[model samples]
Target: MKTIRQVSMLQFTLMVSAFQISVAFLSLPRELARQAGTDGWIAIFFGWGMATLASAALVKVMKNNPDGTILDLLQRYMGVWASKIAAFIFTAYYLLLAYDGFMIATLVIKLWLLPSTYIYVLVLLLLIPTFQIAQHGFQAIGRYSEIVTLLSIWIPFVYLSTLRHAHWLYLLPVIKEGWLPVLSTIKIMVYPMLGIGLVFFLYPYLVRKDKALRAMVISNTLTCLVYLGITLVCYVYFSPDEIAEYNEPVISIMKSIEFQFIERVEVLFIAFYLFVFSCIWIPSMHLVSMNSAWLLGKGPERGHLALWCFAVAVSFFIYRPSFIDAARVNNFLNLAGFVMEFALPACLLLYVAIIRKVRGEKRS
Candidate 1:
């Protein structure tokens, strides 16, 4: 059957980039600093290489079952009950990811721009765009990702303005924290580079399947460069001690920029950043709905209110974490994300490859 909603190579790549690059923007540099200090960018490269291998494995598994997602492959190889169980677990994972983005974006806004606004109000405001894209399915989400990613070009330039205060000394004494800290940060970095695993859900919808892995590499590479650039800028622009003081060093760096034309450019930056941040939640919400729909042998249409409700219910309990609180939660999520996005996918690829080799031997 012809898939009616196939996404192009560019759109697929952009979607992955958008997802990897979004919510991580404000927190990533800070987290990297917390883990590895100024030597953090090295860890980013390590994480990027790790993500590259994981992405290739994910694409390979998808290539093996071109007509179906991992869920379908599980049913074919494992039992129906097992496949459904895996699907439910994956569905829950994406839902949790969606809510994570939702919570982070809301908290960022409350911290920076809309402190007077209620968390529930921010939740509703955020969900409006998320549901609009998710309900329309991957096509809309793809195009939205493309547009928002294009809009992200301005981010680098904004960060560039802060280089006026650049301190080459702060970034000096490379490996000052030793490789141990840098190595630890690799684990921290892996979680944010995780959006590549969405290939399981998105691969079947790719217009040109042959280019999917190539596009995955390109997306992840671009995201890696974006992280590297942001982290480097933060490392150079802020003192090592001062970097630790700010919760969101990327946004805090912007506060150093003073423009006669604009009163507080950081506020404007964070406000516009809400659009880029939406990239994470919108597509994730779609993944949750699509997984649920596919498991039931149904078309990938919308109206997945149950997942949205689950998100809202989660938000009530996860309400307005302090910087330390959010960091603790983020650390926990990163550990979980590493297991799901990298460890499990690598294992799945090995399992699928072995299954194929045995089948090929049988055929021979």
Candidate 2:
């Protein structure tokens, strides 16, 4: 095993926070509106609560086995064969997640910015840096995440400030329909919270210091606030019907803006979003590399193999002749993600807790 140093808790928190806001800010508002009607933001809050609890449970599991990956701890508690099965399932989930991220980015690029270019080329261009960063190990990834966390804060403020032209009446009659739709929207809203799973793969690397849980909770709370703010702005600025009509509500919201200096805000938004995507892509690539290294028992250098494999596979899978097919794959991956990221962690935590209690009773 490669000797991985523990990183600052601050870095860990920032990475988690940045990852949470990036993907959700892009497509979530429109998706939520589709599922929950006008009360989509309500479902967002509900999902936020659910995600927080999930995050806490994940952290607790990490605490129980400090300096251990979920795979490592599972083996300790659930026997080697069972742990191998669980690890395989979890790895498959993350691979799908990585594919979804790549597909979403490719779709956005093809749809809005670069209609003439090939998608595989774009995926390769992005993946090169992602692979390089992951090879630098956890510290580099943490530092990069800290820098992007600042950008994450600034991007939203820029978007929201431009929203002076927004129409608040679009958000009126909150829940014009019954609450059932809002409840149903919970599943839709929860998809973006997949970033919480980053902690499972990264937590063992965090330098545990005073109040580690506090730092993690604060990070989660700030991330939830950012998501809520973005979702609320999208709801209030564009009517539910308008949001449903647009494929990318954030881009559409930006397009609606015009300044004396700038003719098209979408271009500016895309430039910033590309940066955000890069930040997210790096850490995800790093996770894939780290996991692959552990699985293959080839030391840290093996991370490079995983990185290239992911980059190439993702590029091929996403850059299909039919962009529609790529999108269908992305949606199915997101649905699978909800189970892998949220449901699996919850189950693992419960299993560990029950095992601990049973062992304690046997000891007594």
Candidate 3:
């Protein structure tokens, strides 16, 4: 299993898009509206474009290294001890990301479906599948992302039902608030676009490395479309002034949907969204386990991974985060993630480019 072959580009896209779509489903529209009014979607596309450039830099780094993970590069550039320390830091980072997935899912589930349920139970449910999928390594996780994406494909079509009350006038005069607000919200947009950094670790497993850029662009485009469509639908359906009142704008849109047979479809949607949410954490757990395994100078350890997943989940419930606290934590994560997503990639690519140039000169 440690020596498994590379995944197809389609699987690659699904995996990447799945992570991008996860936590954003709940509060993204609301955050955008709060920050930039209807212009929030614009910032989403802009940040996505920026994320694409950052992603391309990462792909360039991977191509130069070829046959290696970031750890292998660290080993080359620094030494074995330094690489081990870097792997440990990355393991902690992946765990932090995994924790965010669990936190976001728990918060949304608690808000939408079971306000009274114990947070511990929700955390347990979220972590169980994370450990199960992370234990199987990337092969099972890739298939799971693709399969879950197929199953959840109908959700966007379901969102269209809310457009019956859509007021196109709400989106009129798109920049009613001025460009400053929209520019400020680009930071918020970068939050949903956070998954691009995972490509550093994922690129080595690509079946067609040359198609890596296309896979990334397509995946980012798909995620941008999803965010754009939902935000557009939300902007039209609710008055601009009232949109900020709802915390989870995308999920709230489902409230208007009442079928003759189905009383509250949003409940069903929120329940099934756990699958969408899983993509964020499962890959995160894999990264954590794989990085830790590398730190130990071995392959992934499912048992240790399982323990770390549970620890992350359990810590949240033990502390019992309030909604405001969660938001604060997310703000910190957003800042950290923005640096990792763009700045780190730009620096790494430059480093790799210089190293390769120096090596060529030595060979000449």
Candidate 4:
């Protein structure tokens, strides 16, 4: 079936925000502290600025063919053969993206919630809801994003409770070394802020295409605030040297909070985050299936979904990657996602501009 333009801007913004949150947020504080010390939070704003510009460029590319996906624009400006190649590359990227998210979620579950469960079993359980939502297409995906965002709204406030003994003095002397360190960490910020590029695929489905740029900016802003808030909280809550010691300072901070009514709130928090992290992979997996079907000259169907799901299940079951393995995948995604999310959009915008100019001149 043909896709429909039914996604509202609010749903789009929430979906984009969820995409940016990813597994990266879990260790974001450690990443910043290790790279830039206390001044690392500054890099988030810089990253947000860069992500916003990249998002704007993507919107402009979509504007060139407002009613079609990137695949359609590629075919129009490049050629059929070129579009297929581009689709294949995109398919690979999204597939890897899905795997990275899925693996991270499984790792977190094993570490905190389900240590004894088999990896393949967890993969299968995760895929069930993912397939159900994704098979229905982008509209269902958009609504799922909206629902998850609303449900997760209170999570940030829970973080605030960790600040009872926070040492505001820990954040003293901004840029302790120099701008060099803070500026250097901006590259580390790239991977987490990447969900904006989904605009390339999501633009055509936007109901208010005129406000696509606005939605992109707002979503990036929301993501930035979440990253910034949590990073700053971790910085003040833990010593600069101590922050990097914990792989996930956000979850570690929860250990400080004690309640008579509850034990191990961090465990509950991690379990709840299973649902939050689902936001990352489900949409990506759907995109994988969608692009795969497009390459085969078929509309999205359950067959493509089943094929990719089986592949993911089998691969993880065989590999059974350890924590180090998952980290390596994340590292690879950091580099690959930068190429796809940041570098490619800028190149495509320039190429599309030149192509349009030449075509206009030819018509004249």
- lDDT against true structure, model 3: 0.83
Q: What lDDT tens digits, residue by residue, belong to model 1 across residues 157-208?
A: 8788777778888888999967999997788886678688788888788889
How well does each candidate superpose onto the true structure, as a TM-score? 0.93, 0.89, 0.95, 0.97
Off by more than 4 A, model 1: 295-300, 305-325, 361-364
Any residue pairs clashing in model 1, and if so which?
none
For all predictions, the C-alpha RMSD in Å is 2.4, 2.8, 2.0, 1.7
Measured by TM-score, the strongest candidate is: 4
* Residue lDDT tens for model 4, 1-364: 2647489999999999998896888998898889999999999999999999899888887888888889998998999988899889989998998998888888888887889999889999999999998887778888998888888888888889888878999998877799999998989988898788788888888898999999889999999999999999999999988999997888999898777989898998888888789888888888898788888987545789889999999998888878798788878888998899899989998898898788784321
Q: Which candidate, 1 or 4, has the higher lDDT? A: 4
Worst 10 residues of 1 by lDDT: 300-309
Ranking the candidates on TM-score from highest down gives 4, 3, 1, 2
Best candidate, lDDT: 4
Better of 1 and 3 by TM-score: 3
| lDDT per residue as tens, model 3, 226-342 | 888898999999898898999887877888998898899999998999899999889998888888888887544876787687687668767876678768867877888878777
Local distance difference test values of all predictions, in order = 0.79, 0.71, 0.83, 0.87
Worst 10 residues of 2 by lDDT: 300-309
Which of 1 and 4 is ahead in TM-score?
4
Higher-ranked by lDDT: 2 or 4: 4
lDDT of 4 at 207: 90
lDDT of 3 at 9: 88
Candidate 2 error regions (>4 Å):
299-307, 310-323, 361-364
